[model samples]
Target: MEIETTGIPGCYVLQARLLRDRRGSFIKTFHTPRFEELGLRTDWREEYFSASAKGVVRGMHFQLPPVDHAKMVFCLTGEVLDVVVDLRRGSPAFGTALGFTLSAENGRGLYLPTGCAHGFVSKAEDSGMYYKVTSVHAPEQDAGIAWDSIAFDWPVSDPELSDRDRRHPRFADFETPFVFDAAKAAQ
Candidate 1:
C-alpha cells in the first residue's frame, strides 16, 4: 500500500496495490507491518460498517477527548464522496476540509487522525463503507459540526441526512476541543 498526504496534517489517501488474474482481482487492504512502518496505528479498538443509498450523507462527526480516535475508512462496495474536516484548534487549516472520491473502482481509502471530523455522501445506489478506529465509541462524547455549515461543494442536490446530523451546530458556534500536535501524531 502507498499513502499520500492530504493538505490537512495527518490525513492520508491510501492506495493499495491490486493483483489481478483471470477470475477477478485481489488487494491487501491492510497489513500491520506496513502500517507500523508508516507510524500508523493498527490495534483497532472497534470496527464498523455502514450501507447507504445515493444522496445519503452520514456525518461530519467525531468523538471528544477520551474517545477521540484515528480512523481508517474505505469504500467496500460502491462509491462516495468522502470528506474530512480539520477541527484542530490553532492549526493553519482548522475548520477547513479536504474532499475525495472513494470507490471500489478506484481502490482508494482515507486515513483521518484524531482531530479530524469525518463524513461521506453516497454516490452510488448502495454504497458500503467500512472503518477501523483506534478508540472505541463513546456515545456521551459523540459530537459534530453541521455538514452544511462548512464551505463544501457536495455533489448531490438534496442530501438525505439524519435528524441528529441536521441538528449539529454550525462550525463557528462551537469551540473545538482538539488541537493538532505534529510531534504527538508522529509518535
Candidate 2:
C-alpha cells in the first residue's frame, strides 16, 4: 500500500495494492507492519460499514476530545465523494477541507487523525463505506459541523441527510475542543 498525505495534518490517502485476475480481485486494507513503520495507528477498536443510496449525504462528523479517534475508511461497493476537515486548533491546515474520490474501482481509502471531521456524498447507488476506528462509539461525545457549513462543493444541493446531521452546529459557530500536537502531526 502507498500512503499519501492530505491537506490536513496526519490525514492520508491510502492506495492499497490490488491484485486482479479472472477469478476476482484482492485488496489488503491493513498490514500492521507497514502501518507501524509509517507511525499510523493500527489499534482499531471498532469496525463499521454503512450502505447509502445515491444522493445521500452523511458527514462532517467527529467525536470530541476524551473519546476522539483516528479513522481509516474505504469504499467497498460503489463510489463517494469523501471529504475531511481539519478541526485541530493551531494546525496549519485548520478549517481547511480536502476531497477524495473513493471507490471500489480505485482501491483508495482515507486515514483521518483524531482532530478531523469526516463526511461523504454517495455518487452511485448502494455505496458501501467501511471504517476502522481507534475508539469505540461514544454517543455523548459524538459531534459534527453542519454539512453545509464547510468549504466542500457537494454534488447534490438537496441531498438526503439524517436529522442529527442536519442539526449539527455550523463550523464557524462551533468552538473546537481539539488542540494540534506537532509531535502527532508527524504521524
Candidate 3:
C-alpha cells in the first residue's frame, strides 16, 4: 500500500497494490503493520459497508469527543466523489476542503483523522463503500457540518440525504473541538 498526505494535515490518500492476471485481480486493502509503520490509527473497532445509488450524498459527518473516530474508506464496487474537510480548530487547513474520486478500478482509499468530516456522492449506480472505523457508532455523539454550508461544489444539485444529515449544523454555526498537535501527530 502507498500513502500520501492530503492538504489536511492528517488526512491521507492511500493506493493499494493491485496485481492483475489472466484470472482476475488481487489486492489487500488493509495491512495492520503497514498502517502501524505509517503512524496511522489502525485500531479499528467496527467495519461496515454501504451501497448507494447515484446522486446520493451520505455526509460531512464525524463523531464528537469521547467517541471521536478515525476512518479508512474505500469505494469497493463502483465510483464516488469522496470529500473531506478539516474541522480541527487552529490547524492550517481548517475549513479547507478536498474532493477526489475513489473508484474500485483505481483501488484508492482515504484515511480521515479524528477531526475531519467525510462524505461522498455516488457517481455510479450501486456504488459500494467500505469503512474501517476506530470508534463504534454513538447516536448521541453523532455530529457534522451541513452538506450545503461549505464551498464544495458537489456534482449533484438534487442530492438524496437522510434526515439526520439534512439537519446538521452549518459550517458557520459549528463549534469544533479538535486541535492539531504536531507533537502528538509525530508519535
Candidate 4:
C-alpha cells in the first residue's frame, strides 16, 4: 500500500496495490506491519459497511471519546465522495474537511484518526462502503455534526439523509471533547 497525506495532520489516503490478470484482479487491503510502520491505530474491533443508492448521503458521524475511533474505509463497490471534518479540539485542522473519491476502479481508501466526523455521498447506484474501525459500535455513544453545515462541497443539493442525520447539530454549534494528542492517537 502507498500512503498519501490528507492535509489534516493524522489523516491518510491509502492507495492499495492492485494486481491484474487476464481473468480478474486482486489486492491486499490490509497488512498489519505496514499500518504499524505508519503509526496508525491497528486495534480494530469491528468492521461494517453501508450501501446507498445514488445521491444518498450517509454520515458526518463519530462516537464520543472513551468510545471514539479511528477508521480505515474503502469503496467495495461503485463510488463515493468520502468526506471528513476535523473535530479534535486542539487540532490545527479543526473544523476543516477533506474529500477523496473512492471507487472500485481506483482501489483507493481513507484512514481517519479519532476526532474527525466521517460520511459519504454515493456517486453510483448501490454504492457500498466498507469500514474497519478501532472501536466497537455503541448506540448511546453515536453522534454527528450536521452534514449540511460543514464547508465541504457536496455534489447534490437534495441529498437523501435520515431524520436523525438531518437533525444533527450544526458544526458551529458542536462542542467537541476530543483532544489532538499525536502520541495517543498513534496508538
Q: Pull out the clashing pairs in model 3.
A: none
Q: Tell me, what's the RMSD of every candidate?
A: 1.3, 0.9, 1.4, 1.1
Q: Candidate 4's residue-wise lDDT over 23-104, tens digit each?
A: 8778777999999898887799999989999999988999997899999999989999999999987788888988999998
Q: Which stretches of candidate 2 lie over 4 Å from their true place?
A: none
- Order candidates by TM-score, high to low: 2, 4, 3, 1
Q: What residue runs in model 1 are displaced by over 4 Å at the alpha carbon? A: none
Give the Å shift of residue 91 in candidate 1. 1.6
lDDT of 1 by residue, 45-122 (tens): 999999999999988999998889999999988899999999998667788888999987888998888988899999
Residue range 13-74, candidate 3, lDDT tens digits: 99999888898778788999998899988789999999999999999899989898999899
Error of 2 at 21 (Å): 1.3
lDDT of 2 by residue, 1-187 (tens): 9999777889999999988899988899999999999999999999999999999999989988798999999999999999999999999999999989999899999999998999999999989999999999999999999988998878889999999999999999999999999799733
Candidate 4 at residue 169, lDDT?
Answer: 97
**Which candidate number would show the highest TM-score if scored against the true structure?**
2
**The 10-residue segment with the lowest total lDDT in model 2:** 178-187
Q: How close is candidate 1 to the true structure, as a TM-score?
A: 0.95
